[model samples]
Target: MGHLRQIFLFLVSIFIISTSYSQIEISGQVFDDQDEKLIGATVMVSKDSVSSILAYGISDANGKFKIAVNNESDVLFLKVSYIGFGTFKKTIQNKAQTLEVKLSPSSESLKEVIVKSEILRQRGDTLSFSIAAFKGKNDRVIADVLKKIPGIHIRPNGQILYKNEPIQKYYIEGLDLLEGRYNLANNNLSVEAVSKVEILENHQLVRVLDSLEFSDRASINIRLKKDITLSATATAGIGAAPLLWQTKVTPMIFTKKQQAIVTYQSNNTGTDVSGEISNFTIKYAGVNFDIDKKDWLSIQKVLVPPFSPERWLDNNVHLGSVNILQRI
Candidate 1:
C-alpha cells in the first residue's frame, strides 16, 4: 500500500508541474534579400480575443526580436520592414512551433503612403495605427491622439497604462528617456518623430551573459522615423488649481547616427511643481535597455513630485492641488 501511494503521488506531482508551466521562447534574426541584418524592426503578438497586444518587441541592431508565447493560438503573423526595404508578411500554424522569418524589400512602384501604412508586421495578433489616426483637429498635442488608441488609458495622474499594467519605459526611436514616467498625458514626444509607437506587452529584458535568460525580465523598445528635425514646444497658462504658470521647453537635435536631446521644464502652480533638466546620447547600434520595473508609484511621484510645503499650504485655503495631468 505504501508503494502504491508513492506512485500516485508521483503522478500528481507530474500533473501539477505540467499544468503550472506552459511557455515557449521564440527567438530569431531578420535579414534582407542580400542577407544584411535589419536593425530596429518592430514585432508584436496578441491573443485572438482581439482585446490588446499580448506580447511585443523590436528587432535589435542585429535585426532580432525575441518573444515568449504560451498555450496555443489560431495563427501567427511575421513581418519585416525597414526604411528602404519593402514590407513582407507570413503566416504560421500552431503545429509548426518555432519560426525564423526573412522579410524582403519592395519596389518603388506604389505610393509611399501605401508602403508606410502596412510597414511589415506579423498579422495574426499584432495591431497598428496609421499616421492619419494621430492627426488632430487643430494644434493638439501628442497626448490627444494617444488617448484614442485602444487598450491604452492615460490616467488623471498622468501615467500611461496598457492592459492594466504600467508601461515600464518609454523610448524615442528606441532611446529610453525619462523612464516612461511622463508618457501618460504630457505631450513630450512629437508625433512627427514617432513613425511608430510600439506598445511591447509582457516585455522581457535580454541578459547578455547568455546564461541569465531564466532570470531576465521584460523590456520595451520604441521605433522612430528615419529622419527628423530640431524643434521645441512650450505650453504655459493658469489652470483651476495650479494658478501660477507652467512652461516646458525641449531642444532636440539629431543626426543620422547621433542625437543630443535636452529637456528643461519649470512649473510653479499649486499642489505639484518643480524645475528639471536631463540629457543623454547613445549610439544607434551599441546599446539598448532591458528593465525589470518595480514600485510604479514611486516613479510617478518622482515624475510629478509635490511642490514645496509653502505651495501646498497656500493652495489649501481654497484651491485644490495642482492638476497637471493634461500635458503629459
Candidate 2:
C-alpha cells in the first residue's frame, strides 16, 4: 500500500482525448469514495511506434480529472492505482463520453476482468472500410481505382469505357494527364496518390454557348494528392510476359492557367508518347453526377443520332484518334 499510494499519488479524474474515423474526442474524470476528485492519477496509452506522445492525462484541484486522444485509440488502456486503496481497471470498449468512475478503498485484491477493464484509454474510428468498396479483385493498377467507379467500365480491347463507351478525356487533380494510349498513365499512375475518383458520365466537354449543339460521352477524372499534382513521376518496372521489362517516364509541369504533361512509354511490344498541353483552366464540381431522366433521354439523341452502317472498309479515323488517347 505504501508504494501503491505513491503510484496513485493524487490522480483521480483521468481523461484521454483522441480522434478516430472522423473527429471524435474521448474524455473522462475520476473521483474517490468521499467524492474527492483524485489528482495526479496516472493514464497511459501506447501508440504506434511511428511516434511517442501516447495517450495520457491527470486530475485537477476540484477533485476532477480528464483524458483525451487525437487519433484512433481503439487499443488504449487505463490503469489507476493509489495507496491505502486497491487498484482498479476498466475497459473502454467503444467511443463514449461523460464517463463517471468512482474508486473505493481496498477491501480485497480482486483482479480486473480483462474484457471489462477500461484501461483502453479511448475508442473511435474515422475510416471504416470493407473489401467490397473496391472495384475489382483484379484492380492491380492505379487506374483500376478509376474503373471501379460506379459508372465506369474498361472495354476488353484496351479502350476506357465510361457509362459503356469511349471516354472523352482523362484528368488527375483536375489536370488533363493523358491524351491517348492511356495504358501508360493507367499502369504508371500510383493509386496511393489519388484522394478521390470521379466518373463523368454523358460528359459534355464544354459548358455551353448555346443548347443548339450537344455531345454525350463520359470521362474519368482522378483527384490526385496535393503533393502529387505539382510533381512528376518516373517509373521503371520488370514483370512477366505480355508485360516484359518496360519503362514509363512521365514528366508533368502544371500551373494555374496552363498544364503540360509529357509521357513516354516503351516496351518490346510498343512505344508511344502522349503530350497534353492546353491553355484551358479546369474547375470541376463532382464526378458521377446524376442527370435527370429527361436529360438522359435527350442527350442520348445527340450521342446516337441515326447510326449509319459501317462498311467493312469504313475507316474509324476519328474513333481511332480518341482510342489513341485512351491507351495511356
Candidate 3:
C-alpha cells in the first residue's frame, strides 16, 4: 500500500511539471510596408476554430508586443489591424513561438470598404459626406451638391440649412475665409474642387470653453481636393426688355498657412448682393437685431404705397469684398 501511494504522488508531480512546460510566450514586432515601426497596432490571439479571444495587446511605441498562452496545444489564430493598412492574419502552430509581422498599405482596399459602407459617417461630433456618392451631373456648384445631401437644404436665396436649421459658421480647410458670409463660397465654388463636406454638430467655437460649455449650433466645413490649389469663377448676364444686367467674379486661393477669397458683384436685377458680405442672425444663438427701425409716427403723415417696401423700392446694388485669413 505504501509503494502504491508513493507511485501515485510521483505521477501527480510529473503531470504538474508537464502542464507548466506546455505554456508558451509569444513576442513580436509590427512594421509597415516601408519597414517603419507601427505603433498602437492591435494584436489579437484566439483559438483557430473558435471566435473567443484568448489574449490581446497593443504594440508599444517601439512596435513591440508580448502575450502569453497557458495552453500551447490549442491552435492559435493571430490577427493584427491598423488604420490605412490591410489586416494581417496567420495560423500559429507549435513552431511559431515568436513573430515578425509586416502590414501592407491598403489604399484601394480601404477605399473599397468605405464605398461599401454608408454614404454618411458620423465620427465623434462631426458628420462627413462622401462626395462621389452624393454628386450628380446637374450639380454645378457646391450649393447644388449640398442640396442632395441628407439633412441639408439650400434655399433659393442661397441660405444653407442643416437638420432644418441654419448653421452658425462656414469654414474651408480649418479657416473661416468667409467670416459671416458663406454664400460666395457655397454658391460660386466649384463642386469639382471639393472632396468632402463636414458638418461639425454641437460645435463650440471657443476652444477653451469646449468642455465646460455646451452648444447646439453646428458649422459647415469644406474640404478641397489635394490637386486643387487655386480656382476662379465668373458669371455675367444681360436682358434686353427690362434692361437688366448682373455680373459676379470670384477668385480663391488656398494653402497650408493661408486662405483668400475676393469677390465683386454688380446687378440691377434686385438680387441682394449684400447678403454675401454680411452676417445673418442664427436662430439657435437667441440673438435678435432690429436693423430696419422706421418711426411710424412720421411715416403716417406721408403718402406711402400700399405695396410691400421691396416692391416700391428700385435701386442698383454693387458690392465688393476681400477676405484674407492667415494661420500661424
Best by lDDT: 3
Question: What does each candidate score in C-alpha RMSD?
Answer: 11.3, 20.8, 19.3
**lDDT tens digits, residue span 147-189, model 1:** 6554577665455666655555554545544543443224555
For residues 72-184, write the lDDT of model 3, one tens digit per residue.
Answer: 55578887877677778898874337799999877666667455233455567887776775687788888878876656777655667887777777889878877556877
Instruction: Report lDDT per candidate.
Output: 0.51, 0.47, 0.75
Lowest lDDT 10-mer window, candidate 3?
Answer: 288-297
lDDT of 2 by residue, 179-213 (tens): 43455456645555545555554456666722554
Query: Candidate 1 local accuracy as lDDT?
Result: 0.51
Worst 10 residues of 2 by lDDT: 122-131
Which candidate should be chosen as best, given TM-score against the real structure? 3
Candidate 1: list runs displaced more than 4 Å. Answer: 1-109, 112-120, 123-128, 180-186, 207-220, 226-228, 236-246, 256-260, 274-328
Whichever of 1 and 2 has more TM-score, that candidate is 1
TM-score result, candidate 1: 0.43
- Greater lDDT among 1 and 3 belongs to 3
For candidate 1, which ten residues in a row score worst on lDDT? Answer: 318-327
